[model samples]
Target: MSPTPSPESMLPLLVDYIVAWVLICTILFLGAQRLKAKIQFYAMQSLGLSVLLGAIGLAHQNTKALILAVVAAIGKCIIIPLILRYVKRRVPMNKGVESYVAIPTTMLMGGGMIMAAHYLTNHLFYNQSHLFNEMLSTGMALVFIGMLVMMVRKKAFTQILGLYVVDNGIFCLTMATVFEMPMIIEMGILFELLLGVLVMGILVQRIHDSFQAVTLDELEQLKG
Candidate 1:
């Protein structure tokens, strides 16, 4: 008879799978051509992170990770997306997302970056815990792809979303390295991210309202 799988033995697999889902969501966000689709993918990606954190907390009996998971769900999964949707409604923007590079090319670049991230993480962290390696690799890939999206997308709103992606990447890195991080620091980081997004949303809306344009190319007219 086959032996039953213990939770201790299964935890790493679960964490790796969730990390993979988070990375996949970022890739989907890269190719999403509609603002709504992009927001949805970002939310899904954040949710995956939240779930991973929660699972880790439950498995290890870590209250801090559990609290952070709830905070992430409230902030990243719900509040952030609502703020984005509200901004979308308030701003007059095109339904189709515009990018300097083609979707297929962007996706290929994202894939290459993911491979590079895995390679670097494996070489540098071969002796680390599996969870650490998975999170670190996904974190680096998220950062790389987020920067790529920011550079290639034309709209200011899209750029802000890319920044959020970068924020998620940083959070993943924190999770991998700072497993015992304090709650105060975690809450502060979440608060800062929320505030930054709120400020950027207002700034972008004002820029669009005054200039009647949201794309980076259009906003370049501000150069004096």
Candidate 2:
């Protein structure tokens, strides 16, 4: 008879699911047309990433990883989304996010990016375990997707959301590989991200107030 699978044995599988959830959220973020929907997707992605980190922490009995997970959930999933919503309310702009590229084309590019990420990870970490490679590749793919969003989306708010995605991706990479970053370093990163978001939010509001639009193309008139 086959032996029952222990929780310890099942951890890698659970991590796979959590990582998949994060990737799915990124795809949803890419496909979503409305600004609010994209923001919500980013929040969901953050929550999923936190879960992944927590799972890894628990598996290894690492206190720092667990604490980082909670901080990530609170900062990324809750605070950032609230700030984004507030910015949305303050800014006068179209409800829908304008894309420089068509949805299908963007999705194709995203798929290609994922493939590229996988290739890069495989080349760099050929000695790593398969699960580790998967996690790292997915994390890198999220980073690429975030950059794509920033490039294709017209609104400053959506660009900020993309930046959040990029930050989450970096966190994922760290959690997957190191599994335990120093508390001071993590705190500094969190503070930097929060400060950046606040500054960007203020800049976005000011841009809207001064230029009457928040789209990069619109803001480019000031480049002179």
Candidate 3:
């Protein structure tokens, strides 16, 4: 006789999890209306990712996942974004609205890139019993898209937010597994992110002083 289905076989929970994934994806693709809105969206995406990670952790009953869920939700999702908001108020970048690639065009291209990623990387060489294994691939795609945004965008501040998005995508995948990335390793990643953003701010100021504009196209002289 066939065995009784495990509680994990519940269809509603699977539906909810997929819905969470879709909701986070939507947040990532949402349009940025202003610098403040952009910060808010970044924060929202981080928060949503934390919750999703935590929910997945609870489903899997992994203690390490629980720890990651708490720390990430508080440290990154809550604290970093508040600091970014304050920084945003100080800098007040209007350049984010003036992306070099027009908004609609960027959105269309971003969607296409996501489709291409699925086509290229969705092929599995082994069994997919572990949920983290699936997340690793999608998380890599999300990180790639975030980097593409940073590369294509002209505004320094927008790129900073993309940096956070990329960081979160990779970090989420890291947390999904039992592998505990050492405390030093985590701190080093944080240090790099902070240093990179600080350098970006300095560069933005120099750009403003030199060109009276923030668009990177103004640095055309730097290229051969």
Candidate 4:
């Protein structure tokens, strides 16, 4: 009879699966054209991240991981998305997505960056846990794609979402590299993100109200 697999043995595979799901969500976010679709993809990616943290907590019996997972879910998955939806409703301008690069070209760039991320991390974290390597690679991919979105997208709202994606990447990298951070620090990071999102949302709404549009192109008239 085949022997039963231990949780320790399965943990790496589970982590890889969740990270891959998050990466896929990131790619979908890159391809998404509508503000609503982008918000949904970002929420899904963050939900995967929260789940990844929860799984790590369960496998390692770490209370901090569990707390962080819950906080991430509340802040990234729920509250942030709600704020985005509110912004979408208030900002009637730029209902269609606008990008400096075509979607196909952006997707190709995103795919290439994912490969580059894996290639870069594969050697550096070879001595560490395999799970660390997977998480780091996915984190790098998220950051790359997020920055791409910020650079190519013309809308303030999309850029804000891209910033959130980069933030999420940083979160994953922190967890992979330093899993035992103080609970207060973790809570502080999430609180700061929540506060930043709120402030950015308000600012975006103000910009739309003032300029009558949210696209960066439209705001170029403010140039001195």
lDDT by residue for model 3 over 1-224, one digit each (tens)? 99875777753355346535633553454356566676666666667667766776677686766676687778676777676666565564563455677777766766765566555545652454445445565556567768867877777667776777677667655644445554643653575467457745755675565455444555665663
Instruction: Output candidate 3 Cα RMSD.
Output: 8.3
Q: Give candidate 4 misplaced runs (Cα > 4 Å).
A: 1-6, 183-191, 194-224
Tens digits of per-residue lDDT for model 1 on 73-157?
8888998898788778776668788999999899999999999999999999899888888999998999998899889999878
Position 89, candidate 1: lDDT: 73
lDDT of each: 0.84, 0.80, 0.61, 0.82
Count backbone clashes in candidate 1: 0
Q: Estimate the overall C-alpha local distance difference test score of candidate 1.
A: 0.84
lDDT of 4 at 180: 59
- Winner on TM-score between 1 and 4 is 1
Worst 10 residues of 3 by lDDT: 125-134
lDDT (10s digit) by residue, model 2, range 45-148: 99998898788788888887788788878988898788778777766668898889997788888889989999999999999987789889988998899899
All candidates: TM-score: 0.86, 0.84, 0.70, 0.84
**Candidate 4's residue-wise lDDT over 1-41, tens digit each?**
99987866788878888888998898888888788898999
Q: What TM-score does candidate 2 get on C-alpha atoms?
A: 0.84
Q: Number of clashing residue pairs in every model? A: 0, 0, 0, 0
- Best-to-worst ranking by lDDT: 1, 4, 2, 3
Best by lDDT: 1
- Candidate 2, residue 19: Cα displacement in angstroms equals 0.9
